[model samples]
Structures are given as C-alpha cells and as structure tokens.
Target: MALAKGTRLGPYEILSFIGAGGMGDVYRAWDTRLERDVAIKVLAERLACEPRSLARFRTEAKSIAALSHPNILSIYDAELEHPPLFLVTELLEGVTLRQQIGRSAIPWRRAVQIGSEVADGLATAHDARIIHRDLKPENIFVTARGAIKILDFGLARFKPAFQGKPGSRATTVSEGGSLMGTVGYLAPEQARGETVTAATDIFSLGCVLYEMVSGHRAFNLASPASTLAAILNDDPRPVADYVADVPEELDRWIGHCLRKDEKARPQSARDLGLVLRDLLAEPTAHGRTGAEFESLAVLPFFTSASSPDAEYLADGITETLINQFAQLQHLRVIARSTVFRHKGKDADPIELGRELAVSAVLTGRIFQRGDVLVIAAELINVRDGLHLWGQQYKRPLTDIFAIEEDISREISERLRVRFAPREQSRLVKRYTESPKAYQLYLKGRFLWNKRAIESMRQALRYFEQAVEEDASYARAYAGLADCTSMLAIYGALDPRLGGKRARAAQEMALQIDPDLSEAYASRGFSLLLFDWKFREAESVLRHAVHLNSGDAPAHQWLGFALGLTGQLEEARGAMRIAQQLDPFSASINTTAVFPVYWAHLFEEAIEGFRAAVELHPGYWMAHYYMGLTYAHKGEFGQAILALRHAAEIGDSIWRYSGLGYVYAQAGRPQQARSVLKKLDELGRHQYVPLIYSAAVYAGLGETDQAVEWLRRAAEQRDWMIAWLHVDPIWDSIRSDPRLQGIRVDLGPKP
Candidate 1:
C-alpha cells in the first residue's frame, strides 16, 4: 500500500508516490533535516509484521549499508523500529531498464555499456561476499546521462550461505523455499533451489544481457513453472536469430554466461567486466581502436555535365549523405564546412585525412540526365589510400531518397558499424516527401553556409519557398532561424525584430521535429548573439552536442558560452573538439584563435592564425585575426600589412577600424584620422558598426569622442560589445571614469 501524500514516517515526509513493486511501495519523500528528496521504500503492513520478512528487511539494509559504489544504490537510513518499516535511498531521476526495453530494443553497444557498468557494481558487492539473486531489467535503472544503477539488493543472499554457515561479518536471513527471483531471469542453480554463490549473479546478468540485446526473455514460457523448468533444462535461443549481424565474439561471450553448468559459466563478475571492455576497445584493421577508425569526411562531389541549376543538385546529394552519416552514433563525420574547403582541390586522401585528423575520406562524382541521377561513391582508407568500398547507382531523380538510404547502409556495413533498428530508421528518416522542397532546402543551406548578408537573405527566400512547398520541413525552418540570427548579428537587421523572427522559426522547427539537433544549435546561436541569454545558450548547445556530438558549430558555440563565464580551460577544451571536427573551417579556426588571444597567448595566436591564413589564403577572417594578434604585439608594420590585405579582400567597417587603430598606434595620426573620416562618411550611407568608429577614436586618444561612440554602440546593440570586459584593444580606456561602470551595463561575462 502506497503512503498517501503528506504522510510522515520519522523525519521523512512523503511528497508523492513513485511506484509500487512486489517487495515494497516507493514514494518520493523529502528529508526534512537535509532538505533533499529521497526515495522511501516501505514494506506492506502484512510483510512488516512477519518475523522472517522483518529480518530480511533488516539484513538487506545492513548488507547495502556496508557497500559504497557509484553504480549501487545507497541506503541512507532505515526505520524498522516503527511499524511501517521503510528504507530511504537517493531519489533517482530516470526510467527503469524495463521501461527502456519496452520503448525499443537496446543497441548491442549500448547493451554492453549498460551490462558492463552493472557487472562492475555486482563485482563491488561480490568483493564483500554478497550475491544479487534477482538481477533483472525491473531492478536496473538507466539515468538520463546514460549511467546504470543496480537496484533491489534486498533480494540478494550472502555468498557464505552456500557454505552452510554465514560469514561472521555477513547478516543472516532466512532463505525461504519459495521462488525468490523473477522466473525469466533465474539462474539454473536458483531454479534447482540449490546453494548459490557469486556464479548465480553472473547467470542472472547473462539473462539480462540477452534480453537487452535481443529484446526477448531468455527463458520466457507459457507459465512461471515452465519458465523455471526451461532455465534448468532448455538453452536460450541463439542471439543471431533475434539480432542479425551481432559480433561473433559477443555471441560467444553471452553463450558462456548462459551455460546451464555453473562450472562452465563465467567465473567472476570482475573478469566479465574486463572481457566486455576488451570487446569494446578491440582494434579494427587500421590498427587503431574501433572508435579511432570511425572518423570520416565526405568531400563535395564533382559534378559532371551539369548545368548551373544542377550544381546545387550535386552538392546537395553530397550534403545529404554527410547529414545521413551524422546520425550514426558510432561514426564521427567531419563537418561539411571543413570538407567543402577541399572542393575543386586535388588533395591526396592521406594528406587530407592527416590535415582533417580522420581515418577515412568519402569522395564521389554525380552526373545528372533529364530525369535521372548517376552517382559513384567510394570510401578510401587514409592510411594506405586503399579503397575499402565503392558503389555506383543510377536511379530516377525522384528516387534520391532511397539512394541516400542505400549509400548510408553500405557505408555503415563497410565500416563495420552495426546500427540498431532505431538508428537505421533515423539515418534514413525522411523529413519531406517533396523532392522540390528538399532541393529548395538544400539550395537554401548552400547559400546560408556562405555567411554573407546578401547570400543569407537569398537563403531565407529559398527556405521560405521550401516551407511553402512542404509545411512540415523542419530543416528549412532551422535554416530560416540561422539566417535570421546572422542578419541580426551582422547588423543588417534590427536585433529586436530579427531575434523574434529567429525564435519563432526555431520554435517551429522543434515543433515539427523535437529531436532536430540543428534546430537546437540555431536556437543556441540566436540566444547567444541576439538575446544575450548565455545560460540558455549553453543549455541548448549542450543538448545539441548530446544529440549529435559531431556537430562542430554546437561545440564552437558551447565554447563561446563557457568562455564568457570565465571557464577558459573548459572553453579551450570544447574549441579543440570543434577544431578536430572542422579543422579547415575558416570561421571555426578564427574563433579558436580568440580564446588563446584572450588568455594573452599572443605568440600562439599569431602562429595559429598565420597557419589558417596560409591554409585558406583568401579567407578574410584569418587575416583579420592575424592583424589583431600583430597589433597586440606592437608589430605595427606587419599588422598594417595584414589589416590592409583584409580591407582589400573585403571592405567592412571592422576591417577599416582595425586599419585605423594600427595607423594611429604607429604614430601616423594623419592616416588614422583619414580612415576615421572614411568611416564617418560611410556611416551616412550604409550601416557601420558604432564600435568601429569608437576604435579609431580610442586609437587617436580622443577620449570624449571615443566614449561618445562607445555609448552609441551600446545603445545600438553592437555584437562586438561582448568583448568589452576582456578585449585588450580597450586597455587604453580601461581607467577612464566613463568606462568604470560600463561592464555592468553590458550583459554578464559570457
């Protein structure tokens, strides 16, 4: 019987009922003294009065109270002196393993992970000579963070019970002659009602592993008696029958656990844990761990005999395949921005892989006929430049959806990745049935990736058409949000108006598909740039990474959020991960240089930004950042040259501002004032960031004029104001009275 809400047992006050089970009723209770939520497991009133049941409850507490492990539930306190006889434990926030299994069959890799953690927990208890007789899905909990916890140690028996005498330190309880464990998970020895040891727990864990991987009970039958009899007499069905393509090694391992003879079963839980770890870390043919070899890059496909309109078609196919690979949890796909850097460049596979830090490269060619598409794709091993897999497909243009699915499946097979059914479905999930809408969405993405104001505005139009073509296009809405935020950040649109549009588009994207990782990323960037909601940005960006760890922009944005909070080390770590995922991306590379520069590593920043400039010689931002680094080091000549190149490559207010600031610092006030005049004249006709004018004034030591412009910049919501606290460029004005309270006016650190 569940305790009613507000029921009080000792210092624990029941807030709500959590669940009820055969052993006890669990309630969500608040520990008054500690002011923390706890789970109270209360035995039934009838069981509380039975002498045997009371002894068992006390024994269970004493056994668990002596053990301490992260994966094992802790007994906080026991109220046995009172009639209800309740035990309190930490309140866990997650679904039970039984509920998880009910949702979908667990992937084999995930099953191994869950089982390995559970085995480690069991080994800890076994070290103290305790054996869990009831290890089943209902008793295993999977936390939101993927951590596994073993529950219901109350049904456990001390290992010394097998020797006919309990250990001196072990608490003794009656081993009733009735069935004590779930029939589906019973060990052969438990079925025979014989003395059980640590081996009994091993057997039960095997049953759990089989069910987790195969989604079927190992010994399920028409009745409980038949299930118990099958456990002692019949073997579980072959795992391959339930799960195709299970690794041969895993099959053998699970079989060893299910051996009816106790002597043939795995000897110890510790040894089993070691075996599972080895299986997970096994090296592939490339002589690296399976995970290391899973790195991949999909290069832009070469278009053959294609018209201008068909150019987007070829690139769209490659982009679609790259996106499909992203859904594979086992594969680390390089971001499209990085891979596209190699477009139209003749780079060797090995060289590209070394530069990108990936083990494989996917390259292909696409040719379009009137209503047909011919695609030839190959996966090359970067170590030896060997072709691991290659395929050619000629399909109706409308069949591009199925072609994407086929290519994804072949790549997974060649790479030795075994996707669970849910993963397979997600990898090929169709967001839109309209080819026209998908093509429009792809064109919009193509333009959005350019990151220019006009290009983004054009992308917004394409996305609008895409949504009109198919009202349920989630990615198109995400693109809409992305373009809208960039418009606000670049000062092309009013921040207040653009922020509302971006939020609405992102919200619509999530409404269509709640698990869209890209939508979360777009929302995160909008929050960071337009809303200045750093905490919300961090939360959504973290969720984006959790959904797709290979998302380079999410990692980069998360780094920005972390950096704003002064977590410089953590921020650098996240940026490094982004660099790994998108090494050749000019924006990612430029952003990576900032944290190093902010940390006052000017020398490192110069070297890194210089390399980025060399890698993408025409990438204006690299030169812009290199100029800033040189200016900080007082290398006026080099800084002028770099800033001049940035201006010549693309004229922008910030570039001219950098040029003017360098000129003034170099003792050329005439040139600096001339550049400021140019900015002032340009501001009359076009939008010029107020911070640019302020930088020039700051450089010329015009304190009043500088502060005036800075005030206008803050009022206008300039995005560059985010660097006010740490930017060395503002050091000259740091001690000014007007700048004293400005940080409080600006948003929080990040």
Candidate 2:
C-alpha cells in the first residue's frame, strides 16, 4: 500500500516517501531522464478502481496542468498506469502555512499579502472555469522567498469540461461525495451540498486568511454534520476579538469576506484581492508621528580641516545633529551609519536621494578656532538638488548644546514638521554644554555601532572617559549604558557586573535628563537579557518609542522585547520599521540572531545569520549565531565549520561549548570531550557550556550523563532552558522524567 525506496513509477525513480494522506502518497523522486528532483503523487490502487474518483483525479491533473500562475503549483505530468496512477507537481522546499500557524500568527500585513496572492491564483483558475473545492491552510505553501503558492487541486471541478456553453448552464455537483470541503473551512452553500461556484472558493480563502491572522480556524466542530450546522446557523468570531492589534479597517474587510449570505461576500476573487492589497497599503496607525518632516538624511558635512581630530569632530557634529532630530516623529532622520558611507565623495544630491530613499539631505560645514565655533548648514531637496533652507550658527565653545538645538529647530521648522508638545520639550532639553565631552560621546557611539566586542569595549572606554570629564553629560551616560548592555549580551562582560553598570549609567542619565530615549532602550535591553524581566523590559521599550518615534534602536529594542514576551506578530511589525530606518545596517540584522535563538527557531536563525555574515564577513557574532543554528538543525559538520570560523575571527569562548555539541553529534566523542576539557582549562565552563555538553551527551545516546548535565544547566539558570519545551533536537530525551523535572525547575515559559 506504501511506496518504498527504489520504487519506480512512470518515468520517475521514487527516492523515498515524503508524506501520505487519504487522497494519495507523495514521494521525493528523481526524474531519471530530466535529472532533477520532483514530487510524485500517486493515487491508491483502490481509489483508482472507482470510476468517479478516477475521473476527478484526472480532471484535477488536467485543470492544474492548463492554468498556470506564479502563485499556483505547477503540474508537470500525469500518468495512467497498471498498478498506480500518478500526478507529478513541482517540489517546494519550505513548510506549509498550516505549519507556520502552529508556531505563531502571521502579521496582518503579511497575511493580507499572502491572501491577495492566493486570491489572484484562484481567480485565474476560476476564470478558466476551474473551482478548487478544497482550500485549507495545508493547501497553501510559503516559499523560501516568502511568496505563497496554492497546492493540491485534487478536488477541483472544471465547468468547461462538464458543459458546452459559456455561463449558460447552472453548476453541477459531483455524485461521489456529500460534504465537499474541509470541515472547518467549508463555505455555507458548499456544506449544504449546493452547486459549487467561484464564490465558494472566495469564502474558503477568507477562512484561511482569518486563521492566519487569528491563529485559529473560522469554525470549530467535531463532525461534518456539526460543522455544516454551524456554517448555516452561526456567525464567525470577529478577527479583532482574537488579534486586538489588527486595524479595525482590516477587521471590517475580513468581516465582509466571511459573510454567510453569498451575495454579501466578495463578488469575485479578484475583487477580494484588491481589498486585501489596500489593507496592506495602509500606513501603520498604532503609534504617534512627529509633526515635522518625518524623514531626513544628514549627509557628511563639508570640511577642509587639516587635523584628523577636527575632521572626526566635524563628522561627529553631523552625527550629533542627526541623532538630536531623530526623536521627532515629524522627522525621520536616516541613521548616521548609512549616510556616512557617502562621506568625502562627490555624490550628486539627487543620486544620493534616490539611493537613500529620502526626501531631503542636510549638508554642513564646521570651523572651530580657539573658543569660537562657526557652523553653516543647508537642507537640499534630494529630488532637485536645490537648497530648501540654510542656516549659520556662531556660538561660544561652552554653548555647544545651544548650537545643536538651534540647528535642529531650524531644520524642523524649514521642513514644516509637527511635533507633539511633550516631544518638543524633550527635544529642547540639552544634555550637556561641554564640546569636548560631546565629541568623545559621539566617537564612542560611532564605534559602538560597529557591533563588535572589541569596538564595544573601546566605545565604553571613551564613554566612561567622557563621563569622568563631565559627570553631568547625560548623553555620554546613555552611550555608556548601551555599550555595557551590549557587552553583557555578547558574553564579553559578566552579566551581573555589566547589568549593574548599565543600570547605573541609565539611572544617572535619566536622573540628569529624563527625556533621553536611547537610555530607556539601552536599559530595557539589559533588563531583557540579564534580569529576564520581560514585562518591565516591554514597558520601558514602549516608553522609548513613544518618547522618540524616529529612534531606530528604540524600535529595534522594542521588537526584541516583544519577541521575548512571545508577542511575535507585533515583534515582526516593529522589526520591519527598524529595518526600514536602517536598511543597510549590519547591527539591525544581527539583532535578529538573539530573538531567533531565544525562540529556538534555529533554522530561521541560521538563514538570518548567513545573510548577516554575507553583509559583514568580519562580524564574529553572526558566525556564532550561524553555528548555533547549525547545531540545532543537526548539521554538525557545518556547525563546526561556522563555530571554527567564529573562533578564528575572535576567540569567543561561547563557541567552544557549541563546538562540543557539534562534535558529539558528528560522532566524534573524543573531540567533544576534549573541547569540554579545553573549556574547563580556559575557566569558561559555565552553565551555557554545561547545557551544550548535555545536548552532546544526548546526541551520543548517553541518557543518564545527559540528564546529569541538564540538571546542572537548570540549577545554573542557563538561558537555553527557555527553549527546552519546543527544541526538536531534544525530542529523543523529551520523554525522560529527568528532562521533564529540569523543565519544571527552570520556571514557567517566558
């Protein structure tokens, strides 16, 4: 009854069975003649004997083979044979939407986008008079590129094949089945055994969208009869009730799709797709926006200073002014890391505008002699390379804060950007007046943005030096908090000491200036990583965003906080905004590593790290995350390669433990044990390493030894404990009483 390895069907050599269901068995097969991989679906011999079932199978094959859309699965060939009748379709690598929904609900925008594509595919099929009677979550697949495709047209009905006239005959029902579609997703008319139409497919797609947004099916019933009764008599729960963050306008659109009466629903799939696209096109409405120009890019200032230190200071000034205005929602300032790339180059303003995708670019020149500071700035329209506004500031050396505020206000007013009253007050509050301290703080931030352990340490040195020079420099304190928090996360500093210093720095910053949003984001990240106080971290991160809507780091930190709290949908949205603000940022991409690691989605994390490494090959943290992702996915050889690469870049002690797990998994127990010994010799055999050793033992099938190490990891409060419940690598030991005890000891899920 089952297709075994080496089984030959038609022109394909079946490699192995992939999966099976009531309809047929799917196999990973080799197309010997074509020399390529293909999925072969073979109908059961019993089903093939039934004339009606055989006709439906052939009709499905023919229907899909004729109608081709990018979002619809392609049917390659069909064969009618003596033993097994088979249909071959394109093989896809990624999981289905059904699997995705099991982990977390898709964001409203992404859900709408996927829904729109599915509708487009179905509308194409419907135009050709083909109706997919069964449309469910399992039938919709998401590709590696994040595109959607509809699969399994096994039950599709073709009107042209059944009738001779165009829209002249009423639709007919097949006699083989009573209930035509999946129970929970069945349309009302379809459940009542009425003629199937395009409206039926539209209703079913609406159910899929509802499931994607709410993480639940539209209907709940035990049997087909019960499901039919509910479909006829009951109203589906409003989507807003389940996902409160979804816009009300989106809820209204979905509500229309799920209407019980056929006429009340969308007239066609094409019409429904347009509505969904419109929903996704709406700008995010959940947060506050600044009153002034919401987005701006600060170009490198023109400077002819002979001293490199002065050149650095001039660049720092440009950065400082950009950071100052970044807080206002009305002004969206491009991150310094992205704009600074064009420094010292003759870049056309219009070309820079097109590349940076900003409406305006601000360029400036600075000249400082003795205690006198002179600066000139101009805002240029990127589209036309014309000056929008210009200003000149002459200030005493001690009044640098006044200079920064004056420049920021001029830019804001020239752009006519609106600011909230509270935001205006915060933007006006000067953190310090010392030019020397401000220069040091800016240099520290610039190095910190490099996101490497050595750079972060150097940045911390400068920040601490700035604070020592002037204790009341609030921005310097904020920079210190950021560096310390990052050091703890990267395992470059002791969590206890780093967290204490980070908190102290943040407290001092806020004490001196409560309007410092970067300090809040920094402190929030520290709380999330060290204290594991998720609620407090989320509160602080939200406050950071509210205080400074244009702060990319604040939104980035907020994304991490939400992800830590298992609010993945909102986390994804926040992450999107961060990416938009810093599109070329290595640091922003690396941030995904921690959240994905904590979430135990090692495969996704591995792909993300690979992308990050490609973007910045010198980034050791990306290599480290890649090693972890490989270790989780059971690719020990690749894991070792990545971990070794990380160690080669910088001897990070964290990779030693990960390498131990990879060694054990690859069946090199001696190497694994030796790595553990080396870790002990280095005095880095902490809880994380112990957990890795436990996983290595488990991989070696040493249950008792694995349990012993797991116990140690739990007692030490190892971070990996958070993923114990869902990590697939531990599936072998999950049933053990010792592992269950360890899970309970680690406290409830975060």
Candidate 3:
C-alpha cells in the first residue's frame, strides 16, 4: 500500500513521496525527533514482510551507518514497523550525478574531483569491510557546496552472512536468476553468479567513471540478454576513442579497474582511492594540469590620487601592464571591461575565485605624485586564499613603459613561465609614447571588449582618434583590427569590405610593431571567416599565442578557429585557457557557443547560449543564439520570445531565417509568410531563409510547399547542407525521397 503524505513511520513524519525504484520508495520526511528534514527509503511491502530480507536490510543499514566520510551520505536511523521497513538518511537538496551527466558531461577537473571524493567514501566503507553492491551515477549526489556524496548504502553488504530470521520467506537468489544490479554497470563476476568482493564495487565504479568521461554506457546493448552477453564477451571501446583528450595513463588506469577478473582489478576500494588522491595531488601527473592556471582575472588598480586625470593615467598604466603580461602564451588575461566589475569594491578574493572559477587573481594600487609613480601589485591564490606574489614599484614617470615591462617579467618569473621570443618582443614594444594616446587606446580596448556592434563602432572611433593623436600608435591599429573583425563576425559589415579593412588594419598594426599579438589574432579571424584560408588562419592563430601566451583573446580566437576546423579537443583546451583567464567575462561565458554552433551541436548550443544569457543579460547575441536553438528544438514560442528580445535589443536581422521558421512552425503561418514577404521585398531572403521556410512548411505538413521551397534552397546551394546529417530539425523530413535527393545534390556527407 502507498503511504500518504503526513503518514508517521517510526520517528519520521512523511512529507511527500519523491520516487520509487526496485529497491524502495523514497519519501521526503521530517525527522520530528531531530527537528530536521530527512529522506526515508521504505522497502517494498512484500520485501518488508520477508523476515530474511528485513534482517539483511538491517545488516546493510548498520554497515553503512558506521562510515562517516563527508562524501558519503549519513544514515541516521533504520527501523522495522508494522507497515514499513525503512532507512532514514540525511536529505540531499541537489540532483544526482545521473541527472547532471544526462544534462551535460562534467568538466574533466570537476569529474576527477567528484570521482576522487566518491573513491574516498568507498575507501572508508571498504575499510569497514562494507561493499556497495551497486555503484552507478544515480547513487552519486552533488551538494550545493560542490561536494560529492555517495548514497544508497542501504543496499550495501558486510562480511559473514547470518541465517534468515524466523518464518522468513527471503532467499539469496536474485530476481530472474540474473545479477541483482543494473545490467550495464554490473561487474563481470557478479553477472556470472560469483560472490562479490570490494573489487566488484571498484569495477562498477570504473564503469561509472567511464560513462562520466565518454557520455555513453560501457556495455550498451539492445536487450538485457545482449547486454549480459557483451559484459561477458566484449571489451569496451577505449575511452580515448570517444574523448580524444583523455590521458593515456588515466585510460589505462581505468581499464585496469574494469578488468573482467576481480583479482585483475584494484585489490580494494582503498587502493583505488589512494590512486585518485595521488592524481589529485599532482597538478600535471596525467599529462594535463587538471584545473590549475586555467584563467586569471586582473582587477583594475585602485588609485590613491584625488585628480581624475591622475587616476586615468594610473588606470592606463595598469592596462599597459596587463597588455604586456597578456603576451605570455599560457596566461589568459581577462579583458579590462570584464575585470572592471570588481573595481572599487571590497571583493573577497576567495569568493571571487569560486564565482569565476579562476586559479589566481591579480589586484593592486597605484599612486602618482609629480613625476614619480608608485605601484603595488599582488597575485592571490584563489584556492587557499594565500598571496602568491607581491611587488612594489617606484619609478620615474618618463620610464613608465620600463616599469610595466619589469612588472610583467617579475610576474612571469615568479609563475615559472618561459616566454617565447615573439611573446618577449610583444611585451617589450611600447604601443605609444604619448600618455594621452595611450590612455585613449586603453579606453578604446575597454569599449571594444564589450563585443557589441555599437561598442565596436565607438571603439573604432576612439582608435581612429588615437591614431590621429599619435600616428605611430601600433596598439590603436590593433584596436581597429579587433573592432572590424568583430563587425565582420556579426554580419554587421559586408565581409568583402570588412575583411579588406580588417586585413589592412592588422597588417598596418603589425608593420608599425610586428610583435602585436592582438593584431595577428584579428587577422586570423578575418582569414578564417572571409578568406577561407584555413591553413593561414591556423598558422596565424598559433603565432598569436606564440607571440602572446598571456593574451586571452588569442586563445579565444584560436579556440574558435580550431573548433571550426573539427579539432574539438584542441579547441576545448584553448577555450579552457581562455576561460581560465577571464572566468567572469561575457565572452568567456559564451566560449562554448561558437564551438557548438560550428559543429552543429544544436542541443549543446542551446544550453551554451542560455548559460551566456544568464551570465550577461545585456548580450543580445546570446539571445539570438538562444532563438536559433529554440527554433531547432521546435520550441517555437520560446524561439519567438528570444528572437523578439534580440530584435528589441537592436540585434541585426541576420537571424531572420530562424525566427521566421519558428513562427511558421508555431501555427503563425501568416506571420512567417509576412516575414518571408518582407525579406523578399527587401531582397534579403538568402538560401538559408528559403531552406528554413522549407523546414517550417514541412513541420506544418505542407508537403508540396515544403518541397517547392526546398528546391529553391537546393538550387541556391544552401551552405548548411554540410550539417544535414546531424541537424535535428531535418529529422522530420529526412525520410522523404525529395529530401534525400537534395542531400545527394548537396554533395557527399558532411
């Protein structure tokens, strides 16, 4: 019988039923005795009445109650009553690892950390001779504090089995004469009916870890029998086959744990825990650095001076120092626009670090008196709230550039960074000798970093004005290149004209000072997007990093190029570096957008765009992407809302096709027809617009109209055909012969 809300069981008062599974029915309950919330897992009525099963359940509860690791869910009470046999556990407010994995694969560092914690909890349990018979993603919970907790110890087993209770009906045999655990995750020995040991848990943990990394099951099959067959006869595809970036050593280690023979696996959970703990301790042990040094946020320098002009000069000096440091290849320097958020605020470094997910933070103060400048800089380690480095610089105003260089060199040295020759040159080159022009250039960069079309135009104006003020200003030309490149990207400028201008601006900037890495990054974007010279784009993007290892924009653009070229792992690594540099940046928040979009990962694109919009509400482009994602997902109302918001924010009409398609599909045929009519009236309905119309019409079951529009789209040679195989929206029409013909006409598969 189902328990109703408010039902009392032992000392717990039932609040509401949460869920029920094969093992038990979970309920949200109030621990009246303890005055706190708890979750009560009551065994099935039949199982509860079975004396032997109840005895085993009690035994398992006692076994779990003894383990006290923070990562293991605490069991508060276990009781037997007339109606229900239940175990009360501390209530968790967060979702399970299963839910998170289904949403999206966790980052490698986070996965490792979570896995390590799980291993630690298992170690504690295994030390007490308790083994979890079932270990899967569903049993791992992530708390709001970002800690991992292992649950479901109510099914765990201890050594030395006892006899069944009097009048008990429970037997040792599993249902269906199969393994007791979930099929895909069961250990080989368990499946073969062999007695389970701690190694079985380790083997199951290996499967969980593998799924976390690869986003697929280790023993996937069409049926239970087939799944069992694979478990007995097959070896899983190497983890590296699915995710190329997984380190070989880590893969081998996990493989060892998944060995068919229990003895071949780790001897105990404690041994596996030790290995994971050691991996966590070594920053670069797995041939990757885990989460260390991914990004840095450089807070604007606070000035003690009262004069506004003096403060501006101090700010300019700070920017110059940042620019110089940004030339280092391994450091991603958060652009000034993003870093300014912390200006003048008494920010807690640790809180900021956690929020931003950056490894280090740089903050300082500057003072100007007459012809002298006094600057103090400090780097704080975010993890430990410890000061990693600090320096005080007092120098003549005339030698401000030298002071900036000295600061960069010292920081790099302290961080054990080795600068490439191009990076060294970029760091040493003075952008402008005139203080006014330098200040104007800094202001221009700050505006350009906003990444909005209007901001780009304003930034271009500032750059032009700066150049007029100082003809030899290399940084101003770099600023112009950045602005023009952004305009070209958003379709705000005709590629033919904008590409030429961007190329000219970048070339001029490099001619003025060949060491300007930002100029090269801009040039790379132009080449990649307009010139379509993939090789040249790759070379330039690589050189940009070589020229300025610390330049966050270089890493960002490089990631973009690599992603477009299908080098996803390398692209993600580059983006990770960019994210590390500017954890809170609007651009960084949306870094995954370009990758997902280019790869036609529509679902991931939708999620990335949503995350971006949440992080920076003013980013109209994010809204635009969200609309595109919604259109692809067949969520027409949401698509229209997002598109309208983008339009209200004055976004360009480049996303019209997506908006029009969604409108048509959402039963707003008149509105879609009107938009298409308007586009035709404006002579702006391109191949993509026609193709989108085809999809919308097809979704509305207007087959003939869909075919006609698709023919037009095919005639015009829509570029998106390269993604047809993977595009989810096309699923509705993929089976139609006409659609197949169009696919053939578009050339071989993308």
TM-score: which candidate is best?
1
* Candidate 2: regions farther than 4 A off: 1-294, 302-305, 341-346, 365-376, 391-396, 593-607, 684-750
Please report, as a residue range, the 10-residue window in candidate 2 with the lowest summed lDDT: 741-750
Whichever of 2 and 3 has more lDDT, that candidate is 2
Best to worst by lDDT, what's the order? Answer: 1, 2, 3
558-650: candidate 2 lDDT, tens digit per residue? 887677667776787888788777776777777755566657777778878899899878877678778867877778778889888887886
How much lDDT does each candidate structure score? 0.80, 0.74, 0.70
lDDT of 2: 0.74
Residue-by-residue lDDT tens digits, candidate 1, 1-750? 567888889889999988887657889999886666789999888888778777668867877886766567867899878778889987788899999999987878778867877887888888988887889998899755344678887777666544335443222223555777778887887777766777778999999999988989888899998888898899988898999967879878998999998889887898998787567657777887643457788888877533345678778878888877876788888888878877877566567777887888877767677888777676766754434545557688888888888888777765777564577777878999998899899899888877777898899999999999998999999988888888776657766677789899999999999999999999888777666667778888999988877788999999887776667888889999999888778888888777787877899999989988988788777898799789889898899999999988853456788889888888899999999899889878877778887888888888899888887776766667667666777888867898655542224443
**Residues 1-750, candidate 3, lDDT per residue (tens digit)?**
668988998778999988887667889999775566788988888887667567657766787678766567868787765556788887777789999898997654456556766777787787776778778999898754344678776567675431223442222236547456778888887778767777778888999888888888899899988998898888899988989877676778788888998789888676676576455445674775433564566677877533334566656666776676665666656666566767777566557766766677777767677787767676665765434445556677667677777767666654555566566666666778886687678678666756677888888898988999998888788788777766755546655566677788888888998766778888887766656554567778899877666667778878866765667777888988877666556776676566666566778888888988998888676887788678776777788999778767744545565566677678888877776766566456321235656655665667777778877755543433433544455666667787666542211212
Worst 10 residues of 3 by lDDT: 162-171
Model 2 deviation from the true structure expressed as Cα RMSD, one decimal place = 24.5
**Candidate 3 off by > 4 Å:** 1-297, 303-319, 329-341, 350-360, 366-400, 409-426, 566-574, 597-600, 655-657, 673-750
